[model samples]
Target: MRLSSFFMPTLKETPTEAQIVSHRLMLRAGMIRQTSAGIYAWLPLGYRVLRKIEQIVREEQDAAGAQELLMPTIQSAELWRESGRYDDYGKEMLRITDRHDREMLFGPTNEEMITDIFRSFVKSYRQLPLNLYHIQWKFRDEIRPRFGVMRGREFLMKDAYSFDIDAAGARRSYQKMFLAYLRTFARIGLKAIPMRADTGPIGGDLSHEFIILAETGESGVFCHKDWMNLDVLKDAPGMEDDLQPFFDRITSIYAATDEKHDPANSPVPESDLVSARGIEVGHIFNFGTKYSKPMNAVVAGPNGESVPVEMGSYGIGVSRLMGAIIEASHDDNGIIWPDAVAPFNVGLINLKSGDAETDRVCAELYAKLEAAGLEVAYDDRDERPGAKFADMDLIGVPWQLVVGPRGLKNGVVELKRRATGEKEELPVEAALAKLLG
Candidate 1:
């Protein structure tokens, strides 16, 4: 991508309405724009990051044996009514009526609809332990939607539904999702701690919320200090393994949101506890018959008895994660995107764009980087060096390669790592080799 023709409309000043660091940085960096009080229009740069995150979530879900299938944004209110939650879901659900006077709604979640789908085709226990997921837009009419995408009313989400024959099978599915969520966050360069959380409207007895600690988090959290040292991918069991032991070990780590924390009753010593603010990015629930029984989503058991299939729902806030990442990773200069989720892997800055030598060097490097399967943003505009540097930093590409007439004359180019602010001067071949490696 060439910055000279890019559509990024970066702002020089912070918007007054942005109260949080993520919201302010996103606006100033031209990643997103507010279309309404709680809705945002993701621009090109932001959309790239969003899609990257979504793909990560999808990959993890697939690896955990969940199949992908998109669901509609508009849901039939009859389904919600069948699950006994149409009215109980409250004002957050955007209830509507079609021109023909049939009730409809923009779904906040898909428990009811998914249950209905399962019952339509799936019959005996042969189809047990099935998981289906989708990445789609969701809406909740928040009374006070603020902080950009963090608490936005309209946002993208990945929701998965798991169906099992019984409680034991359901727990297995839950554990798989638990491990998958941990791996998903880890791959995205986030250390998300799974904390016991309330099921809320989901009505589940067993639930966990995957939270990443950030100063700008919406809620306070308390956890065992050891959670920071744990490497989920290294320690977790395989997909086909008996996950009970792994699940037991993780749930015993003593993490909790403020709503569930009891300092006096906590097992961990005060000294071993780490209290911090955290943002919730994913949530999983094993709600055995919550939706299935109410909606008659039953299947024949081994004993030939009809039973409600145990069900679990997992959800990741696909859009809110962008704000969370910014909150956890940004610095005074701007966002410091993680390598896996960066919009562009590298930003090629031509300090003197009009200079033939500098432009030639930058163009060559850009071509090489792209040929090596890297996403490169080449700054080819006739802009000042400082402005180019600032814009590169603001957008948070993982690396920045600086080329100038002086550097070209010296037979070297400057490379900077965005996260660490480390710089090195190396020959063009050396730089290419390092980047390719």
Candidate 2:
């Protein structure tokens, strides 16, 4: 993509309303723009990152044996009523009435609707152990929506529902999802620690919130220092293997939000405890028969008895993850995007754009990089070299390949790594090879 034609409207100064690092950086980097209090329009650059994160979540869900499906954003009020939560869900739910005078709502979550869907076609234990997932937009009317997409009222989410015949089967599904979340965050260059969480009115001990530690996080957390060194992607068990040991190993790690922390009775010693702030990015609940039983989503058992199918709901904040990533990865200049989630693999800069030799070298390198199956952002605009460098750093592409008349005359180009701020001058061929590798 060429910067001159790209629709990224970057700002030179920070917006006063943005209180957090992620929110401020996102605005100045031209990743997103606030349309309302908490609603945002993702611009070209931001949209690319959003889609990349969504794809990663989708791939991880698929690898865990979940089938993908689409669900509507608007839902019937009758469904929530049947699940006994319409009245209890409170003001966060955006309730509305259609012209037909029928009650409707922009769904905050999909438990009730998914249960209704399950009971419609799935009957008997034959379809047991089924997992259905979707990536869609959701809305909740936050009283004080702030911090950009981090606390947005409208956001994209990936929610999956798992149905099993009994508690034992449900536990296995939960374990699979547990490992799946670990691998998902790890792939996105985040070390998310799973901590036990409250199940709320649904009432179950089988609940966890996956949190990533960041200085700008909202919730204070306490965990074992060992969590810092554990590489979940390297050590996680296979999806089909016995996951009990892996599940136990992860849950046994002393990690808890401040609300759940008990210092007097904690197992970890003082020296090993790492108290820090964290952001919750994903949550999984193994709420047996909570939605199914209330909504009468039953199926015939092997013994020919009617039984309520055990259900679990897992959710990952697809859009909020963008802010979380920025919070965890950015430096003073701007966001330091992870390689897997970066919008472009490389930023190609023609330091002297009007110079024939500089343009020729940059264009050649851009073509070669693209031919090697890389996403390259070529800055072909008539801009100053300093402005080009600053913009490249702000958008946080993993690498910046710099070409200038002086460098071209010397038969070399400059390659800089965004995250490490390290640069090397080499022949154009060598630079291309390094980027490809």
Candidate 3:
């Protein structure tokens, strides 16, 4: 992609309404534009990052043995009514009426809808351990939507619903999703700590929220200091393997959101406790028969008895992760995107755009990088060197390749790593090799 043809409308000053660094940076970087009170239009750069995040979540869900499917944003109100949550869901639910005057809603979640789908076709215990998931847009008219996408009225989410025949099967499904969440966040360069959390309206007896510690986070969390050093991905259990031991190892540690924290009853000593503000990135629930029982989503058991399938729902805030990642990874300049979620792998800058030698060198490097399966954003515009550097940094590409007449004359170019601010002057070939490696 060439900057000359790119539609990034970067701003020089921060918007007053943006209270958080992620919101401000996203606006100035031209990644997203607010189209309404709480809704946003993700621009080209933002959409790329969003899709990358979505794909990571999708891959992790697949690895956990969940099948993918699409669900509609609008749902029949009758489903929610059957689940006894239409009115209980409160003002957040966007109730609607169709042309035929039938009740409908822009679904905030899909538990009711998914239950209906399950009971429609799945009739026996043979399809017991099925998990279905989808990545889709959702709306929940937040009364006070703020902090950009972090608390937006509309957002993208990856929600997976699990159906099992009994409590034991449901627990296994929950453990699988817990492990999947850990791996998903790690792949996105985040160390998300799983903490006991309230199930809220989802009405689950067992629930966990995966949170990333950040100074700008909205909620306070307490956990054992050892959580900082534990890497859940170090020895991941197989999908079909019994995961109780793995689950026990993680949940044994003391970790909780403020609502669940009890200092006096905590097992970990106060000296070993770490308190910090954290942003929630993912949540998983083992709801037993919460949705299935209420909606009469039953299947025949092995004994030929009708039974409500045990169910669990797992959610990862696909769009909110953009803000959470920025909160955890950015510096004073702008966002410091992780390599896995960066929109482009490299930013190629022709410091002297019109200079024949500099342009030739940058063009060659860009082509070589692309050929090596890298995504490159070439700044071919006639802009000042400082302006080009600032824009590239703001957009947060993992690497920046600088080419200038002086560097070209010396048969070398500059390669800079965005995260570490490390720079090396090397031959074009050497730079390409380093980047590829």
Q: Against the unseen true structure, what C-alpha lDDT does each candidate score?
A: 0.93, 0.92, 0.93
- What is the alpha-carbon lDDT of model 3 when measured against the actual structure? 0.93
Q: Write candidate 1's Cα lDDT for 1-437 as tens digits.
A: 99989999998899999999999999999999999999999999999999999999999999999999988999999999899999899999999899999999999999988888899999999878799999999999999999999999999999999999988999999999999998999999999999887889999899999999999799999988888788766777899999999989888888888888888898879899999999999999988898888899999989889999999999999999999999999989899999999999999999997788887778888988999899999999888999999999999999999999888899999999999999999999999889899
Candidate 1: list runs displaced more than 4 Å.
none
Least accurate 10 contiguous residues by lDDT in model 3: 230-239
TM-score of the candidate numbered 2? Answer: 0.99
Per-prediction TM-score, please? 0.99, 0.99, 0.99
TM-score, cand. 3 vs. native: 0.99
Q: Against the true structure, candidate 1 has what lDDT? A: 0.93
Cα distance off (Å), candidate 3, residue 64: 1.0
After superposing candidate 2, which stretches have Cα over 4 Å from the reference? 201-203
lDDT of 3 by residue, 142-259 (tens): 9999999999999999999999999999999999999999889999999999888789999889999999999989898998998888877777688788899988998888888887
